[model samples]
Target: MTDTASLGLEDRTARVIAGQRVWDELTPLLASRSCTLLAAIAYVGSHGGELIKLERGSSVIVDASVSAVRAGSTDPSVLAEWIGAGVGVYSLEGLHAKMILAESAGGSRPAFLIIGSANLSGSSAARLTESVILTDSRDCLDEARSELLAWKIRAGKPLTLEEVRALGEHYGADRSPGRKRSEQDDTHDAATPSEELPGSTPEASSASRQRPTQLLLVRLGEEFDPPSEVIYHRDRLSSELGCDDADSDSVLFVFRDQSEPEWRLPLSQGAYVIGVDASASGRVTKQTEVAPPGPVVYLYDDDDGGRYCYLHLTESSRDVTWADVTAAFESLGEKPEFDRNYFRKSAVDALLSLWPEY
Candidate 1:
């Protein structure tokens, strides 16, 4: 007799997945055989596609509007990769729902319906407090799939691989250098804490949540040592900054001349947007090794400019100068005595408005 295993179709239950468990459950569903995936998520980060295993019969709908791309929310290049892998990638403007349906098309496995507040990004799993209602109910899965399909149909024409790639290229070429803010605004000063900090309330509103790319402002002293390689202390990252689960696409902006009582411009002409690969609070050494190791953060540049590049600085501070760099910091309430600190997305947008030639 052929060995038999139950697909667990009779179990029609749902459970809430919060914290890191959200990704723990999702990986298996994405890798399940004969399970067709249908996702309608709003934001697709630069590495979002890489997280998916790319099922043959998968179909994904995302917000691929020009505004979303320019805002660095949806990456068209990621969608292009999915399309290249034979995944049906569709673009729906202003799509905000995050739902994934994995149903066995020609097998005995039970269907899965995942509805949650998380986006299709690594940050959602790592940084955000996301909860998904996972159910093995085939009926619920079918209904959710139908609704997603309707949205897909309403999205109009599907994007071709070339078209998506071109869009990504266009976005890269057409991105603005930076925006300017009035020097009078100092609401984002690192010295003055924002009203809605992390864990300030019993529950966090949608507005209180941190952005995908949180900015780290490093004040480089005249005598401060600059490491040839990018590194961050684990304690400084976790205990001090509460960025224990910082996204890999996070940024680091350096500034100079903090020692001066009065300075013309503070923002360094050279800034490295460090993409944190790995962060260890304590010494992490090989099991077989006896030598002590120091805390470190593995850094790399991802090549989407300073914004997404992982390890290296996409722009050299030696190349460009921002005429209003000091003004930009002042607008964000950056104090003269400020040292290395973290800035939110709103403040980052205000300070780092200019890009390549800033």
Candidate 2:
């Protein structure tokens, strides 16, 4: 056993962390801007980036081998974000170790090394039985640094944006959501041969396969033109749409007018789709006061059925009407009806194309 007192650990240094205790030890180190991080882990599941807050100069190496991507063990989407943020993301075939290295920003303190079974994944952090050894001892740090350096060299060049995008496509295709009756029975007329629908573009197709966006329909008390901003009651959303605050991420909401004909998408107006957080009373509302740069979408209801849809694009986007949208869907053997609020990017793009440009 290592001497914890000498290391100022109070029974800490060279400590073994298991389960959520790993985060209890790790988050403080990451929160310090005075240190930089490098992680060599075999698998990074979807949205795994949320776990490790990587600084600009930080680095990560994962087992992004063909089999890993196909198995959904490595998520290219998170990798793509890391690359875009100028983080050095690399791939090493046959990499199975889970390790992290943290060095003082100015190289003032001895580097710390964390090694063991925990992966940089939600499952590992939240549910899996994981263990790791954390130590700032000089000898262990030196040996681990050397090992990570050797692997980094073997990793060669960091993945380029294009390479990561290609990997994302492959990953998405392999792990495509399994077809279900709920998704198909409402929108799709029938399963026709796989082919691009009329007016479909590669960009549209790619965007559609990405994370699905939810459309929240808020009914207005009176019919009128699009307002500068609209307010929504969080409690009402929970009661009507079963949309809790936690489900508000990536959600785009539109106001429905209390007019005749029941236009699900009444008009195209600018709306903010910011992240939602609960208020003091355990409810979220437009007045909750959140930051900006969140998703902004133009709201519209197809009016074909009592369904609302949201376009992923912003105000300075394309415009179309229900007629244009239905024509495109029908061309591909799909019905114009959008029974549910969750829309794939393809559906959003289709709606964006028909929505009137702001």
Candidate 3:
């Protein structure tokens, strides 16, 4: 007689795993299971394709909200495949929980349940920094199953094959060539310089030769003095700002001062500092009183005729203050007081005490 204890069923309860550990454990478990049900507030179709290919699952429920579409999280192609494969498909308006329930073949293996911050997408499962709690506890599994059932009964709307097909066609058309740019795409384009400028010749119109006449330093609500160091490059600026065009007039350029250790801006936060041309004219339309939680500084370089080295805060925090910005500059080895006299000097020594040597 085989000892069930040796099968490691008891050891599977209540553990947190992240990254590739999610894919490594989830794939084999799905393959061995007879019935798998997935409920996620968000779902991507490619992930659905992969899941259906692994095992014939009973059902999948996802949220079909405009926000998900704007974020490019849901794919209709995968949803169509789900319906074609005889898997039941459902959508709920406000579904936000992510859970998976799987029952083993013929009661031969322990049932499994997963709950976590991960979505049912390949990027979330394999690439993103995601964590989930997995367990085989009968009590937990039963409770999860019951709640999911209640949600389905009260909110789930069964998607018919025709509806899935129609949605797939709509998305396909939207993705087809010659489609109009989306508002999000346009916002991204505003920050990028993809095409040649309107009236200048290629030689004189180069982005490297354009110097912003004014630099604007702004936080949530108040504006500050521009930082002395600025570095501009299309790729770096685009990536840092989470936009496409690095040379848009409508958007502000933000970054951290180079004096601090290299840190990428967190996406969830709303705080930022903007860099504008001294020649540009605009009022501070956006407002936020809270400062970013940590120290942030700005840098700029105008030697190449391009605005570079703009720094801004990305995280949202109510505790950040002007003192934090001054302190970050002080940490770079010198604490020069800023005053009206300091602004009068244009020489390198006057602009930045810790400027990098080229």
**What local distance difference test score does each model get?**
0.48, 0.51, 0.43
Where does model 3 exceed 4 Å of error?
A: 1-9, 51-57, 170-358
Worst 10 residues of 1 by lDDT: 288-297
Best-performing candidate as measured by TM-score: 1
Q: What TM-score, over all chains together, does every model reach?
A: 0.46, 0.46, 0.46
Per-residue lDDT of candidate 1, residues 183-264 (tens digit): 1011111111223222343331211121212244332222324343323422232323234445422222221222232222
Comparison by lDDT, 2 against 3, better one: 2
| Best candidate, lDDT | 2
Residue range 249-281, candidate 2, lDDT tens digits:
323343343334333232221122222233433
lDDT of 3: 0.43
Q: After superposing candidate 2, which stretches have Cα over 4 Å from the reference?
A: 1-8, 33-35, 106-110, 172-358
